[model samples]
Target: MRRILLGAAMAAMLAAGGVAPAFAQGNPFQPLVYVNDSVVTRYELDQRMRFLQILRAPDGDRASAEQALIDDRLRLFAARQMGIAASDAQIDAGLAEFAGRANMDVEEFTRALAQAGVEQQTFRDFIAAGVVWRELVRQRLVPQVQVSDAELDQEMQRVIETPRITHVALSELIIPAPPGQEAQAMRLAESLVQSVRSEADFAAAARQHSATPSAENGGRLPWAPLENLPPSLRPIILSMQNGQISQPLTVEGAVVLFYLRDSRGTLRPGAKEQVLDYVRFRLASTAEANRIAALSDTCADLFVHARNLPPEQIQRQTLSQGQIPTAEAIRLAVLDDNESTIVSQGGSAEILMLCKRQSALLAGNAQEAPVPVTAEGEEGAAPDPDALPDREQMRGQIFSRKVGQAADNYLAELRANAIIRRP
Candidate 1:
């Protein structure tokens, strides 16, 4: 009951960013592994582990948890190298964001963390890494990434023409969207992703305590009509399984959760497989894709009203994903409704923004049909479900194949340039 109530408060906070006074908490000192200059103490790892438990990791992947932490450290190191730190204010905001996703009061969330045997800072460290990582990538790596107007148009064409599917109940946990307290939410959401990857017990996790009402039925939200879900979620669902979950994204006031169920459509031949990673902000079912679209439109409306405000009075807003959308993205991307503001990298829910240069590797779209292939000697295999992305996400599917290519290229360069000591 407490967990449920705290979750409820967290959701409310996500909609409105406000918290109580901080109480004196105990000192934190547990240490685990040291990543270069940084140390992931047992205390930190324990909190991380707790969060992962919430994510519902698979048993096979549980042992590899350390790798995820290491990757986070690597990203942290990069963020630092790029001088991108998630500021003090950002940390507070992130904590608030977490509480919001959980749907609790900040103070309530603080207490919940305490009850969970997690320190408040547990969320801080987790969220800070993501903040810094994204900032660093946008600064150092994003420069090398690019999306052509033609490509955007092509994606738009696909979104307009494709008639794929709806609801896909994934066998995973739903990551939440950004609220002022988004840090906690992201960690919760990301940890769920990691947990599902490790333990492969998503439904169990959902049943135990998913904040969504669907938790009552084990995180099983009924199949959303294809037209009802946001384009972002819809496309991502296309490539997932009947039990695959979505990555988190902020829709309206609450974080929307997803578990891919099943898809229905006549997959085309020779078409690229539609691979989607449904990214949703942690919010509620009432918050739909159209709501996000309406929010984006609202932000534009706010911008029109911004003509009268003093420069200092203007909100120092950045695109939530660190880039402006193309005309196609504007049409397809979910924007904040209240102010018509582009979701900012600093996070959303404010008025006014300066649209600077957009990043190419931010959010995107992709499409592929399952292709069954076998050895040259054998008959060409029919497309396999296991190899395909969730088909339920359908037309809005955007897989950053390029970013992956970039990451791979980056790693290759690192291996080529590094000096290794093998004992």
Candidate 2:
């Protein structure tokens, strides 16, 4: 990343050399752009110029496109060979379907495509690549994949039932370190943290010192879901009160001093374990692929026999996916470790699962929380009109989420096989 950016910055500097009044310059071919392997060809440069003339790109937009193309070429060269390739028919079908879905007539779609500099053929290739890659992932990778029922149930419970949460947002100004400047950077970081702690108001100090673009917003960062923050940042946030500030945290390349402004988020608050209880068992990594598969297969068998088990037997026998052989593999394979669980009694794989022993208790009446109960008896707090989601919307959210998870897990497998060359 540094190599790419530093090279670009250097290129930008070289490009600036030509800025000495174009009107006063004698006609000469300047070194317009350079890549590691070769300079941009005159023919290529002329083609871009012609494209600019015809397309009427904004000032420096053509240059931006050229630089982007160079970057793309470099990336392609550095990436491993792909076995994934979409067929012509598939690409065509996908394009047609997408255009139709967007409610654009053929001509209108064609015009819109031209405006975006997007060719139908290129779009087709992109879709085809995805189809091919997905197939590759399923074949060479996904067969080895397993999803622990334990993880799945855990996630589903978390999502379907969210905790009410609150947060305080903050922006921080970091002092940058030059090459061989670590000592100086630390000194600056310590000084900055101290000054922010002692002197002026957080907002004032933030505006004066923070290098982040949000300085004008008084160092106030946009509210983010707790999960969106870096894992290291999470505990600190959790430990904070409504309007408290934090000490300096060492982030990569810089020190961060954060001040909490305000936050609102889903807070799990806590739960009374019930019949629907989902337990999470963090697994150990061993004999990855085969072990996980065996665990999964075993869990499936146990789940089939769960109804026959006695109460005590069920509690003792059912194991989470994470507990079994290849437990980590089981977590990765099932793809929804947080939402699913496997349960069984008196089975060998039974104790391997992260079991959610849903106690024989119900949430509504026995230890009732004041929540609205549906006619079919799903207990939840009724929305206060302003807070409620429409029925269709709620359904859509779940569906979209399921679809998204499938896509992500599919991609993750492919990424594991990919060979990335940094240089």
lDDT of 1: 0.49
Total clashing pairs in model 1: 108
TM-score of each predicted structure versus truth: 0.40, 0.32
Candidate 2: where are CA atoms >4 Å away?
1-85, 105-107, 116-118, 164-270, 274-423
**Considering summed lDDT, which 10 consecutive residues are worst modelled in model 2?**
359-368
RMSD to the true structure for each prediction, in A, is 24.3, 16.0
Per-residue lDDT for 1-423 in model 1, tens only?
A: 233434543443333333322223344455546565666544454456655444333321434555566667777666666677889887777777766766665797676555545577766777787677656655666677766655554555454345455333343333344446454554465556656642236677776646566565666555456657665555666655555666555444444446665666543332432211211221222233235445444334433444554544334333433243454235323432232332332323232322232222222323344454566656575654322243334222333555556765764554354332211
Winning candidate number (TM-score): 1
| Candidate-wise lDDT, in order | 0.49, 0.45
Error of 2 at 325 (Å): 35
In every candidate, how many clashes are there? 108, 40
